[model samples]
Target: MVEIKIALVGQPNVGKSHLINSISGATLHVGNFSGVTVEKKEVEFERDGYRLKLIDLPGTYSLHPYTPEERVTKEFLLNGEYDLILNVVDSNQLQKNLTFSWQIADLNKPMVIAFNMYDEYSKRGGEIDTEKFFKLTNIRAQNVSAKENFGLEELFKKVIKTYQEQNKPRIYYSEIIEEEIENVREKIKDCRFDKRFVAIRLLEDDEDIYKIVHEKPWFVELLPQLNESKQIIKNEYDEDDLKEIFFEERLALSKGIISQVAKIAKRETLSEKIDKILIHPVLGLPIFLFVMWLLFQATFNLGAAPMDYIASVFDSISNFVGKFLPDGILKDAIINGVIPAIGAVVMFLPNILILFLGINLMEQTGYMARAAYVMDGILKRFGLQGRAFIPLVSGFGCSVPAYMAARTLKNPKDRLITMLIIGFMSCGARLPIYVLLVSAFFAPEVQGNVMFAIYIGGALVGLIVAKILRIVLFKGEPEPFVMELPKYRFPKIKALLFDLWIKTKTYLKKAGVFIALASLAVWFLSSFPRENIVKEYSLKIAHVKSEVKKEELKEEMRKKILENSYIARIGKIMEPITKPLDLSWREDVALLSGLAAKETVVSTMAVLYGGNSSNSKKLIEIIRNSLPFTAAVAMIIVVMFYSPCVAAMSTFYAEVPQWVWRIFYTIYPNVFAYFAALLAVSLIKLFS
Candidate 1:
């Protein structure tokens, strides 16, 4: 079979990733692009005797990149290896989407257009004459709905046909621009790219393209003519910015071609109708909060349903293993260390999944954009644009991806400020700690409300910190926020399940491996150096006559062993700092282990408090009885504001190269967390 490599390209919200997911019999590989945190998705599948490999490029608006993700797309198109370009367009927004389509046409590559979301368009009485479009631009087009999975096979057929024919875009621009392109094209000699593409990019003053052709043998001669061509275009268009001129040129071409090839439905969309109330200036923020409150309520209540059953199952496993393994370090580690610790974290999986599902539903249904729109006004008051809201909200899921998502912010200062405060967003990994404490301290009816309060409170404080940072460190007015809200559509079951499956897999893997290993380490530290304690306890039990008193002495012996264990020593060193918060050594250890991952805080507690039994149900009771109400609130406060896990921290370090900012990012959150915890403890004491 002949092999063809296709680069899948599109503007944002045009269903690019969905299209990839819809491909039948495709094998996918996901990884970060070289030296960048932006995700790269590639798929390979065979169709009709041809092997097709598709590299899904990041969604971008134009060749002139405005964001880091956009630059990644542009650089790949200019330099990455690919045999054909498959540009997906939102059929409902042809005017806007086609502007970027025309820009890609200038690359002069073998191209095919997949008018994605065609089902939505067709339902609304829209039509696109692909034959006319092909005749107009010499690039084949297909109307495909990646979600509905219609017209996809035909789209790929066109893709393969375009590759077979070596077809390239025959699009032309305004006469004046064409004349300039011709002039610059003639001067270009033995260049790697199509001369027309080079000429156009030069006219647009593309810095990346300039770097490429600056060292050419004909550069000295081409320089003056290139300048003259730019001047001619500027004079003819009556615009000083040649880039603007080129943008308008493509935009005009988009309008001209779209008029002939498309019949756009002029009726108001359902999205607009929904946005009327959902994004109302006066009511939007409250509605958003209510929605979040419901989500957390469901996350806590619904997720709690399976906890006892999951706990029972794990308890059975631990008991079975205990019966089989002889009493020693191995058995204690397996029973107390690995089983219960993993069980404690795994018990919270349902909560994490419910939370993820809620967020995914908002995103897939296109309400996420409206959320940003609603949040933009409040964010601006806090020295952040609405765009910063996306990453900050993403920080609720996980900080690693949230930091990566900050790439969408074009301003370096905005990106930095947003990332710095993301830690305060209370990611899902931290949810278990909150749920555990909230369940232990608060009444059942109020637990969900407390969970919601935790999230909203963190976000509010983060915004306040953002405003403070703007005044003291990076002072500037926030950039204007402009976003296109996608048409509302029902989320496909397959896609939603795929997302949930990935989340479940990731959470399980972390629990099985990372948490288990951390628990083992905790177990070793808390279980060892027990010879002296065990001997003393044996003598004391031997001297006691009553069996009940003997058991009491045994329990005392266990606590004494834990007090002097290696991990306890470490926690003691930090106790001076936490003493004001009314936190004990065990709570201190749990918080410190959380620096590795928030989930481990719960796992560490299970290992330390559950002692001999290792049952989550018992662990919770022990915690409620062991810790004071003030201490519980202080623990929650610290977890909310403290530095994120090591993975998140390292990701921040990688994304930010400046050591000064990195150091500040690392140190400030912990210091802030300590003070916050102390204040919470003091206030509770004063009020009570």
Candidate 2:
């Protein structure tokens, strides 16, 4: 089959990845771009007897690179191999998106423009004449909505046609800039880049381009002419920075072309009406809190039914495995260690999925951007950039990506501050622990409210800590907030399901390896050093004549064996440290094990408890009856404020290189959690 390689590029939040996902039969592979940490995604699919490979470059605002991601896009466009450029433009924000488009058009490659999110734009009475756009810029254009999967087939067809014709863009700048470009282009001799492109970059004083061409044989000849051309442009534009002058030139050209092709209906958009209340300074914060509370409530309450069903399913599997295998070490490990540990973790899948669904919906409907806007003022007061809200909110889902999301904050101090406090947001892995403890301790009616309080409480504490950090460690004026609020539209069910499927697959995949191994290790630690206690207990039970006496002897023997186990011994060693929180040895072990991954806490508890009982009661029931109210409260608080999993810490370390900050990030949160839990236990005990 014929293969067409297309470079997919767009600004941030322009639905570039969404468009790749919308295509039928596309297989996606994700990795880092060569020599950089920025994520690179490539999609492959077959359409109309042709195999297409789409390289989804990092979303960048301009070819003048600002962030690492933007540099990746710029480098790939200039040097990387690709057949054609598929520029995805946000239809509603044409002027800004088109400015970037003009920069890419300077590459002089086969190109097609996709006006994405046209569905939302059209709903708000915005119209784009694609034909007029093509006539003005001499590039094929398609009005498409990647969300609704409309016009994608036509868009791809145009892409193929453009490639077959070997068509390139004919974008022109103002007369004065063009005159300087021509003069520099004439002097440029043996450079790999298009002369026009080199001339423009030279005019803008691009250091990267200058470095490249400076090594060329023709540099000695070109330097004098390049300086003269730049001087001429600077004089004509009456500006010191040629880059700014060139930027304004592109902006003006974008505006002029937008006027010719775009017809604004000039009506009040639904997003605007909703934002008045949702983003109101007085009401927005409360509304955001209410929405978050509702999300947790639904995650716990709605997920309960399926959670029970999953638990029962695992119970059946364990029973079946028990009957199928003979009573031995392998059987014991599978039934007690592997089955229960994995089952405990897997049972919470419904809760994770439900929470992700809510987050995905907020993102799809454009509420997430408004959420950032709403929180910017509050976050700014705490010395975090408004953009930090994205990563902070994302921390509620997971921290690995949350750390990456911190890249949006351009200021280093702000990004580091945001990364440090993200651990307090309480990720989904910790939700199962909360659900277990809350269900065991609190009444059924208030369970959801209690869960909501835990999340909100943690977030509030995170903000306060951010404020403290700003004052003590990295004090500065917060970066100004500049964000785009996209128009709201109904989320497509297909897109939501696809995203959820990926999340579910990722969770299960992790469980199969990481959770399974951790569970087996816990089982070994708890079950080992098997002495002759079983034989001794059998002898005593045999000697006892009465049935009640024999059963009581058996129960006492089981407790003794567990108390003598290695896990219990280790827990005892750590008991003095956790004693202030009123946590028992077993609870101590579980919490310690949680440092690896939060879900392991539940798994650890399951193995520790389920090994001693053949009762039909669920793990939650057993835990509820086992722990006191104060211990449960203390455990919840500790988990809320403690250090995140090893993976999240590694990600943070990778993002921030300073050894001192890494050491601080490692030591501080755990210390904070310990004292917080100690205080919580003391207050509860005093009140009671």
Return the top candidate by TM-score.
1
Maximum-lDDT candidate: 1
TM-score of each: 0.82, 0.79
Model 2 Cα shift for residue 221 (angstroms): 4.5
Checking candidate 2 for backbone clashes, the offending pairs are none
Quote model 1's TM-score. 0.82
lDDT per residue for candidate 1 within 1-688, as digits (tens), equals 7889998999998999899899999998866778765668889999999999999898898888887888899989988999999999999889888899888988889999999988888888899999999999999999999988899999989998999899999989888889989999999999889899999999899999999999988999999999999988888878899888888887888899988999986675577888888888888889987886787677666766797789899999999999999977688778887897677557657766776787678788987777778877778898987768767876886775567557556567788999999999998789889878899899999998999999999999999999999889985554656677877878877778777776566455543455456556656776788878878888899899999998778777777776778778899998887889989889988887787668778977766675434455677788899999999999999999998876577557767768899999989998999999888888888898
Lowest lDDT block of 10, candidate 2: 608-617
Off by over 4 Å in 1: 385-460, 469-477, 506-513, 535-547, 575-640, 643-666, 675-688
lDDT digits (tens) for residues 70-189 of candidate 2 = 888998999999989999998888889999999999988999999998987898889999998888888999999888889999998888889889989999998978988998888888
| 502 Cα displacement, candidate 2 (Å) | 1.9
Model 1 poorest ten-residue lDDT run: 506-515
Tell me how candidate 1 scores on lDDT: 0.83
